[model samples]
Target: MAHHFSPIKFDNKGNIRESVFSILRNAILDKKLEPGQRLVERNIAEQLGISRTPVREAIHKLELERLVTHIPRKGVVVTGFTKADIIEILVIRTSLEALICSIAASKIRPRELDRLELLAKQISDEHGKGNLKKSNQLNNKFHEIIYKTAESPRLYDFLNTLHEYITKFTEVAYSKPGRSEEVWLEHNEIIAALRNRDSLGAESAAKRHTENSSKAFLEMAF
Candidate 1:
């Protein structure tokens, strides 16, 4: 994994620290950097063709996000979520997501509704063809549209923080037999409620989707 990163090229536009942080964060989320894997600052620095300072800084940021841990004498390692952590995050996410869907149902425009339908159909097609990654991307796009339509920037930010941890294992959830098809059907229900502009129905569907996702993640992760 240390040699996985190519040489870093600075575009001089984005902050180097942030670039490093994002790279490391995505690697962790993508499972390229597995839980409990030790992170060697020197090796990472060499691989990215950068100094250890920014890598150290990035590790600290990931630590704050609870994606990494600084173990005494053992150095830093990736952190894995406990079952309790998963439950707590899902419980909060389910409620907040429901509210977000309710808000989106009221504010989403007709064009956006049509786009949602298009995305939903695409996801179903992708899943049928066994393209889980494309399906997941579309699924994320579907929810992101709802979050954007909700028009609550702060709420979106908070929800994303919760998502960082759970998002990593979503592929595993979808890989479970029949899970992807179930999720595709569930997303259609949510889209249906949104198209009808039924705030209550949208909220209920969103709630159920999250609950089912929680079960799938737990079954896969634990």
Candidate 2:
């Protein structure tokens, strides 16, 4: 674990436990902490230069989130997402993203639409150039604009909880052959529907995009 995490420099402003929880959670999500890797509280506390209490609290939170599990003999171990977990998350994402696009069709302003068009073009260009990291960043921004334009704070917060998992799965999906190009076309369909204020069209396009993404991830990841 020492190789995976650096020592934390605690600032006075934030809760130590939350920070530890975030660090450990991200490690699991990012695959730095591989599945089945044991999370020893004392070792983590020593590595982070924090007291055992905070590390214990962080591990408890991770357990609650299902990112880790307490094995009787092995102690706390990382529990990375299983196939069923991925399916569940993607299924939920499909519905939420479709709803967002539908709401955005009515609410998106001209300037935001313009920005989305630019992002779509940039993502396509980046993909053509084989710059996947940059394209993925632009892709995230493209969706962010639509959701923000929808102006539903509660919905936004709900999606926010799944953001990291979505990002991770999307990265895998993009690695599939022709997946990037397919996503660009899907994005344009979404943009066109939004521009026309066609809620049903936008919703249908968004649903198709997410469903395709889920297919790509399952094909590539499994």
Candidate 3:
């Protein structure tokens, strides 16, 4: 088990338990700690140069986040989303993002609009260069701008939580064959709608973008 786990580098100023929790959470989200993989507290504590107490606390935190589960005999194992879970997330995202786009189309300021356009072009260029990771980050930035421009902090917070949970795995969806390029085109459509201040068109474009994204993730996941 020690061989399977990597030692965590802790920040000197950070609390041990919080650092442990962050490390473990990121490991789970990154899929290094795979679904159904048993977590050994002793091994983790030893590898991380920490006591079992902090490791236990970190495991508790992970459990709270639904990133890990405890079974009667299995102890704690990483959690994986089901096909149904993915589908439900996608459906919710499509609706919420469409609404966000509609609101943004009506409320977006010139500065924010300019930033969005720049991000779109940057994503397109990065995608053409086969820089999928940067392309995805820019893609997220573009949508995030719209969410911020919507002027609803609570709505953004809620959608952000949902996005975090599902996108941990689906971020790689853009790396699939031609998804990056397709996403650029979809982004352009969204920007065009927003530029025209066409609320309905913006909503439709966002819906279509999410639908295609959902399809890409589903195809890769299943």
> What are the per-model C-alpha RMSD values against the true structure?
2.9, 2.6, 3.3
The model with the greatest TM-score is 2
Give lDDT tens digits, candidate 3, residues 1-222: 323555666554268887787777777666787788888899898888778998999899788767889999879988955667667877988999999999899888888888988898898788888877787777778888999989999889878867555455447577678887788788889888988999999999999998998888877767
lDDT of each: 0.84, 0.89, 0.81
TM-score between candidate 2 and the true structure: 0.87
Instruction: For each candidate, give its TM-score against the true structure.
Output: 0.82, 0.87, 0.78
Q: Is candidate 2 or candidate 3 better by lDDT?
A: 2
Candidate 2: worst-modelled 10 consecutive residues by lDDT: 1-10
Best by lDDT: 2
lDDT of 1: 0.84
| 1 against 2, candidate with superior lDDT | 2
Name the TM-score of candidate 1: 0.82
TM-score of 3: 0.78
Q: Model 3 off-target regions past 4 Å? A: 1-22, 40-61, 165-170
Considering summed lDDT, which 10 consecutive residues are worst modelled in model 1? Answer: 162-171
